[model samples]
Target: MKISLVAPAASLFAGVVSAATGPFLTAVDSQTWIIGNEIWNMTQGPKYGVKLYYKDHDCVGNAVGHYVSYNGAANDLAWTSARIVKNGTHSGVPFIDILFTAAEGDMHWVIFSNQHGSYQYFVNRALPTLGEFRTLWRLDNTTFPNGRTVTKDGVLPPLADYLPENKIQDETWRTPDGKGYITKYDWTSWILAQDFYGVYGEETGFGSWYINPGKDYYNGDETKQELMVHRESATGDAVQLNMLHGTHFMVSSSDVFPQGKMWGPWLWYLNDGSRSDALSRSKTEFASWPYPWLEDEPYQTRGSVSGQLTLSDGRPASHAAVFLGDTLPSNKSSLDQGSTYYYTATTDASGHFTIPHVRVGSYGLQAWSGNNSAIEDVSSTFTLPSLTVSKNKETDLGALTWKISEKKKLFQVGSFDRFSYGFAHGGDPWQHGLVSSCPANLTYRVGCSTTKDWCFGQSTKGNWTIKFWNPATANANKSATLIVSLAGYSSGSSSTIWVNDAVVGNLTSGSVGSDGLVTHGLASDPSLYRSATAAGEWRYFEFEVKPGVLKEGKNEVKFQLTRETQWHGFMWDAIKLEW
Candidate 1:
């Protein structure tokens, strides 16, 4: 499956540091100190008492100079607070303390001093008990004053200032035209103190304590409250205020006073401590039309269609289609045509459907919903034999019985008879046998030829009778005759036997035999008889043309042959009918 890739948009404030200085800084030489000069440069004038001198002819004398020098001579009261020295020159001791105090609000201060050719800035802030002072910022002179400044309120100026004049800072935050300051709090000490201490302390005689606009802040007075407010309304219910260092203050407060829940609804927006509230109160309302509603039920087959859908109320929805295709509409195609054996169905109100009786091949299933336009499409293929029905016979195929007959060399035997018979002497010669006379007696006599040896060594003088019914009437009409012939013996010299048209009792000669053969007689018979020719020989016979006596629906013809000698046995073949 191929998936689409989306390109992410460029970040709007990618390199903007949430803190007063870039996170990384290094000093290369003792004379060159990397310092967060933006705080000093913005709060104090460019020619303040601090001087950062670069050795290799790098220091230039200009309004924004590489060597920042005061307007007065050194060591004098004016110079004490005015002239900043790099190497403690006779003109003045490098007023590192002045540059250090320039970067302070409240009691926290950062100072830079030359050592060899490199410079290092150190910090000193008053903590309750811990003597460890925290380092706030740093910068490399090569990169510093590059195009940044620290405002008196501790905010960094736009990079355009130190960058060549031609390069304009990207127009990001809209500038207020003819406005004295970009932000009303730009000149406030509360903002500067917030930048230094990262928290609003007690309100000063100068102005109101700088609490986050609309954010609840605990005041020292405990009764009256102060908060920043947006006079103009915005679309979203909540507003965002630049709390300066309030994030660190809140985190520190939570850590120090572990028992108090200092942090309210503010959630960290990113790795930085900046935060945004839950959108629960946002004016932008979002909603989905319908919901998904399928369980992980196994499909009947691999190709079977399955899915889920949901309703607008964010609840499980039923009857919504998850697929659509050739297999749908569980009902018949048309009222006049009746139902097809295969179709699809929607789930009940609970959204469940099982489509049975599908063809034993691949088919498509689709889902649909009346509410939402389109949800999703899944392609599946299933193979199941239960879905198919046999097309050939109208009758139910419960069981089948098939038989192979040895005597007739036929494939199937619908019916057969088990009987024995013999002929009576001088009774039309062909009508010499008494056929099927006893039902309880199992023994039958076989008549043997006078020329052949007989069983018990006695002359085979008497004729025997055998009789059976041919219930196979699948064949009818057209000169049907039963012919009997012998196997397992060579014979040319037996007396002629006869076939009769008799339905019961004595047989009348209808055909005569010659050379141990039953001749084609003029009349077709319901009863057929053949005389034995030789000892130990097996004779088999069937109807040549179906007899006229055989009725159309079903008829039985009985065949009987005499076995005079008791040792001679007979074998019968299944009756065969050909149309």
Candidate 2:
């Protein structure tokens, strides 16, 4: 049996559109929506920032499918309440409306009501069904499970729904009651006016709107056709949605590891599952910059860069690692230098790569295909051409053809022999057991700080362990080079590590190298490195695991700070294994 709905009369809806009938206008255009008003100020840092990873997600822990995350510190602060207003009439269906208030830890995840003598709380739910919000608020206390008190489902109308069938166009839609028309715009395609690193490209023009899929709920369901978005701040950062699968293709850019930043985005299920009438163009597609993320001025304008890689014979260079750099590194140990190269991507089988949302500034690209080579113009002395990016523009370098040349390799270790693990490549994915919990140190950061990349050193855990399995039985006979980037207090503070339950070396000796990178036997001493050092900063250390020590599998490396110092005991940004 089909459920029948009674929608408000069109004439009645039109008349009530003004606050005169109630208190405020219910309908809002894309131009006048709450884009920045819902900023989710995260405190944990960048690792939680939006990038296209967690689309259509729910309120989960550190999982990759959450809509927003902030510092646990900000969880107790007061936030503004959001009020919903209807934009047009819907097909006749009776619905209820109410006010919602956030609860414990600013979990804003609550819909309140009273059932008899007990209270019902609806929070942290999946994306509510279209035309019917699964939660409403009135009273409060706290009950789990289902609620049947004074509650009515709220609804949000979607912009369009064309997928696996056709594209959507801008058109009017109505409620099942055939009494109202939805005229507000929802989806936005923000142009590349800024780089992914909070760097803007254009000052003004050809784009009034920017795209951000901020705070959304339950976005990654495969059963529905929905969209999701996340934006940290006002520029560069963005999230992509797959309306077909009702999810975001997060793993697309493997290097866009989460950092942490602001976020917001809300979506609705299409009235019709397989089709939509979404707008193909908007004022942004034409021109304008409504809101500018005012930070440092130059960080605002953004642009794009695209090019093809080919070998001397005209064949494409497939699977080449491409990097657009602000600074150059000496080698793998130059963790700080590598971070200066903000943009990183791998080429497709066709040898073509495009790095969009690049900060408009002076930059160069380096390609690694068995050898390190720069993409440069014929007359240029550098390996790469002096490239430039303009706001709302694409800097296209037709084809970068390369010929085999003598070069040094970053890693000479054999077959996946170099097991690279670090916060720079996204924190420890293996069994990193902790003897003590790490304290949330404020100085901890992403990219380069003290010439080190990212690390798990933002806390005061005296004993922490990072373990891995050397599964290659055939490769078990050789020694492994364990290079680590780390820092700690030198005032009675000491660094210690146990490989395979055996102590290797100790660093109480103040003089390791001018650069502060300590090396036991293999790798260059600090004096040999190009990185500059100061009193209190990060340093590098290389330790060669002795042969006959590492068995076939299940090897462990334990780290402990011998003496208590300051700032989270000891800190590290990366851990590299090369044999």
Candidate 3:
């Protein structure tokens, strides 16, 4: 039985054809809808700024699948909310439908009811043939133990029923120990269907397992699909999901090693009628599943890139990193949607590097050497002629040289490795309590100060003093550059430098704001992963030191966070004085 729904006659959804809603408006054309107000805009950032466009055939136009975009660039349509659906009519008026699909491919919907004066929403699934929508915010359908599809018994239909015809069966699947069974359907669908029986059926076990299948595309080719199995264990025995090769295809399970491509999902069920030695048996079976990941490659459609890197002084930049990346958006976030279309490789001992299996596209090349306190750090962004890669070809950039800026250094506080590694609390930067525990007025003397004397980052708006001694007389004729390297900075905040009493340098804004002070890592969020690196992209601010600014005996330089709050702060990478 196909259970359709209808909205009430007089409600917030009255006169759908005659009235215009706040969020939803009548379409001006097949692809355009004139919104009543700005439901979402680009200035609001990614969370609320993203827009999804879908066609509503009921609005006198051809209906089409929705497409998603962030700011203005197109993004995948899956995994995002903000959907609009229109269901059956009520008293000659159409109303909004709230049914949605879950990541696990389950059907769920929301129902509305009248509270005091507004509407309240409740959620449930389409099972058990519930005539009323009063289930109250949960999918509480119990498991059925029958050995059939369970459509008549109030359970989710078999997964095969929803899959396409070509993907219905997998006859090549087998257990790790050579125990195999023949199924009328494809082996992949058959195994998933058998597991679906135990999964949808309730068991008072210590752990629960579910399948979350995902796809992996190599350079926009989606021929490979991987299963992501999640184990929700109550006893804390399961591991968390991890990303591999920047692909979202991941598995969360227990006691298994992750390989390159041949890695598959394994379930460890611990309940009644299960073996007591399941952990040991599962480990042995996991080892026997496959050898090194050896999947067939689409080399005919992909290409490779090779290049050599050398310092300005004609020395090999051994172990340096080279990147071939697409053009970044105007305002780059801390992490841009997981590094897709970006390829990286490391130089060999002789500074030769080769990146394999790269999709054919035009890319911008960048290279940077590793950290070396002996000499200054060197990095370069190349703007050469169009570098267009073609199919089944190897693009060689030949020999490339990086030029380092020459400077007569007087003194330096840190290296240009793009980190706050040596400063105080640098190793563990998430300690927000340090703002109150440490002294408000912090001071650092050039010769006597140790790494512990300097804080990793500044959290509040204040002036931190740095005292340095100079033996030479002050010379206004000779030019000097005071370089300040920052690893992270918050939005709408500024940093200013004052030498003795005159302002030397000021940074008013950045491309995009980052959370660096409270969480001293480059990653978007510290709760997801606490990184040892700095918070955001590296930015250099060079201030000129006027002749009379530096005195012979002693001079004071102040670094101030002019507009700072607890949440708005920046992390310092290094400071240097060069003539």
Residue 28 in model 1: lDDT: 20
lDDT of 3: 0.38
Alpha carbon deviation, residue 266, candidate 2 (Å): 23
lDDT (tens digit, per residue) of candidate 2 on 1-579: 011122333442333322122222122221111110011111111122111111111111222211222221122212223333122222332111212223211122111111000011123222211221111111101111111101110122322321222321222234344443331112211111111111111211001111222211222111111112222111212222212111111111111111221111112111111111111212232232211322223334578788888866565666565656543333322112211224555667777889766667666666644211222111111136368778879989888876642322112111111112223311221111120233332222112232223233433435545555666775467777665544222233455666776665554433454343432322111210101011112344667677777778776565655655332233343444556
For TM-score, the strongest prediction is 3
Backbone clashes counted, model 2? 60
Every model's TM-score: 0.15, 0.29, 0.47
lDDT of 3 at 345: 62
Model 3 lDDT per residue over 295-350, tens place: 22421256888988777777786766565654543133212222234455667877
Off by over 4 Å in 2: 1-304, 308-352, 356-362, 366-462, 466-477, 485-494, 501-542, 546-555, 565-576
lDDT of 3 at 62: 22
Using TM-score as the measure, name the better of candidate 1 and candidate 3.
3
lDDT of 1 by residue, 1-579 (tens): 011122221221112112214111222222222232212221122222122222212121222222211111121111112222221221232223223222221211112222112122212222121111221111222222211001231223333222232322211122333221121112222221121111110121011011111112121110011112111111111111222112110101111111111111111110111111112211111121010111112111123333333433343434443222223333211111111112334545654555432223333343333112121111111112122222221212122111122232211121121111111211111111112221212222222222111111111223322323334454334344443332111111122232234332221123454543334332211111222111111223443442565444423333333223221222221223333
Candidate 1 TM-score to native: 0.15
Cα error of candidate 2 at position 468, Å: 5.5
TM-score of model number 2: 0.29
User: Residue 378 of candidate 3: its Cα lDDT?
Assistant: 45
Backbone clashes, each candidate: 62, 60, 7
